[model samples]
Target: MTTTLTRPGALAASGHPLVRPQAARHLTDEQIAELGVELDAIRDDILAKRGATDAAYIRRVIKVQRGLEFAGRGALLFGRNKAAWIAGTTMLSFAKILENMEIGHNVLHGQWDWMRDPDIHSTTWEWDFVTPARSWQHTHNDLHHRWTNVVGKDRDVGYNLLRMDADQPWKPFNLGNPLYNAMLAPVFEWGIALYDLELPEYNEGLKSKADLKRDLKAVGIKAVKQFTKDYAATPAVAMLTGSGKQALYGTLVANAVRNVWAHAVIFCGHFPDGTDTFTEENVEGETRGDWYVRQMIGSANISGSKLMHLMTGNLSHQVEHHCFPDLPSNRYAEVAVRVREICLRYGLPYTTGPLPKQVASTWAKVFKLALPGKGHFRKGKPASA
Candidate 1:
């Protein structure tokens, strides 16, 4: 997926690396402690804010935010079709992008909740449907923060078989090749149900009972059953009546698009072939902080426009994201500066190519890791010991 993106709009300029590559290593414990201070400040703000009210002043704030997002696309969005949107931005679907930034990512990271409601704890295990938020917590917090691509258990590294880096066998494949699924990523959320959230908990849950696997399996079954019911309801939406159907259809279609969209972005993050997935034995048993450093080393941050950065929720800044999971996502541009310093300090491989480069790299990772070859047969023994 190496690209010669020296053209305009590319993250490269002439000969220098885009965005000034820099990185650091061995931050004093003081640095880590400082992050805790930052968290406390954010927590205090959340405690002071009041609830969302119809007549509240913050409604104005939310409205202003919406206006910013609406004008961002430069179109009046009142049930207009794609043809109407064509009159505005030419580069991307501004509405979906706005939704991702304004609604999806914030909810995923619980930014709105963070500074408004003090009680809501944004655990990686719950909340935020878009951007595969739980997956972010697991991939960023559990895997990157805790293990950071340590291979066997880190959970971020994929690309060895047809499965996603963090996928588990759902149904039988072809005994061998069949057990592995290919690029289920794009539409995996609809079909795989709670696979994203469930896998992390199952792998990293508290010390468990004798029937832990059985309990986990029950969750998986329930997730699929619910997803299937929802999927089947999509097309039948037109059949629903009254305002009830109108609301349901609108919600259903919006979610269908966003859920699928989130998976596509996330899958390309690391499941592709060129990305490396080092096991525990290879990287050694790294400490928690080392894992954060390693995830930045292995991950690439795809560059996009300012609006693209926000609407897409700085996912384009993938490296910064995988590094700082707790920071308000809006601040990635600021933290990214320090990341550049760190990369240079450690002589680490910090990849932050443009979108084209990121996509190409991910495509390569998919084929290289997913193609079943040599003794790639499944054990065929059901989920048993």
Candidate 2:
């Protein structure tokens, strides 16, 4: 199914303030309300069906991830050998990816909270990333998710660093967007840790000095633990086995691979060519339906095999994730189908593409926005299934 933009008021009649006459397809307020109801039903249906299968799926993935990490570390002890180094690095890379993406990310989202298990619960699950879990939840789940792509409202728009949207005032610092992003990718976890600190908020007097100090302390603790585990403790053990340097390098490369992959996946989700950025005024009087519409238009998806989807924590279904973020990641594939159908019926855009294409499009936008200009990237066309 496909949809296209219509002229302002071409199909709308409900004069709802939330209805953007300039939208890709003009939906009447009544239609938007109906869309919201359908989406709500999808959420309800998934919640109802959540059961032992979902529980088992998460448990199985966790077991595999743990086993891979154990084996990778074991292999690193023999890393003085060329084959051992390659094997350990490869396994460790996959381990870190699985842990960060499939397990840690979803667990932190509270996807398994329904089970009432404290071990895998969102409040207790500290992810492998450098950012403290609580800080990330505050900035990400609380702020970024609520704001999505609203220019100044969502800090994730450019993480307060890059000129991602033309609406974002251009500064001389923005000319370094490409370079900043290049550096950010390999150290993405570190970047996220710094971003979660919300330094800009502190500087602007929105955050209190005491709170910033507390958050900084938490980040310091988390960073120290991560560094010790990856760079110190593991390598120290391998040192006793005469493979200290090899083990250190293996962990270093594995972390870099995970960071780069994570950066790419996340960038593909929200910064791609077709995804829209909103203004604060656009969400001033937002309703349930309006919020759904915003998420649908503000995010893009990656189309690929199930493996690719799993690796991305099912964020390949970026549109669906933005809509029903608390739902289990394992269910996003099914949710995406219903969501796409809804988009077709309502003449909304469902922006999606392969990973490479999305990455190129996102980077292109970064470069384009870096220069001083009023030109905005063209709105995304509806993706065909």
Instruction: Return the top candidate by lDDT.
Output: 2
Give the best candidate by TM-score: 2
Q: Write the per-residue lDDT of candidate 2 for residues 1-385, one digit (tens) a residue.
A: 0011122222235444542423534777688778878988999999999999999999999998898899998999999999999999999999999999988888887888889988888978888999998898888887878878877789898998888888778888999999999999999999999999999999999999999999999999999999999999999999998999999999999999999999999999999887887766566556677778888989999999999998898999999988988899999999999999998888888999999999999999889988988565534222220
Q: 113 in model 2: Cα distance from truth in Å?
A: 0.2
Summarize candidate 1's per-residue lDDT along 95-118 as a digit string, tens digits.
Answer: 444445444444445444444444
Worst 10 residues of 1 by lDDT: 1-10
Question: Which segments of candidate 1 are over 4 A away from where they belong?
Answer: 1-140, 159-183, 197-256, 272-274, 282-289, 372-385
Give the whole-model CA lDDT for all candidates, comma-separated.
0.44, 0.85
The global Cα lDDT (0 to 1) of model 2 is 0.85
Error of 1 at 325 (Å): 0.9
For the record, the alpha-carbon RMSD of candidate 2 to the native fold, in angstroms, is 6.0
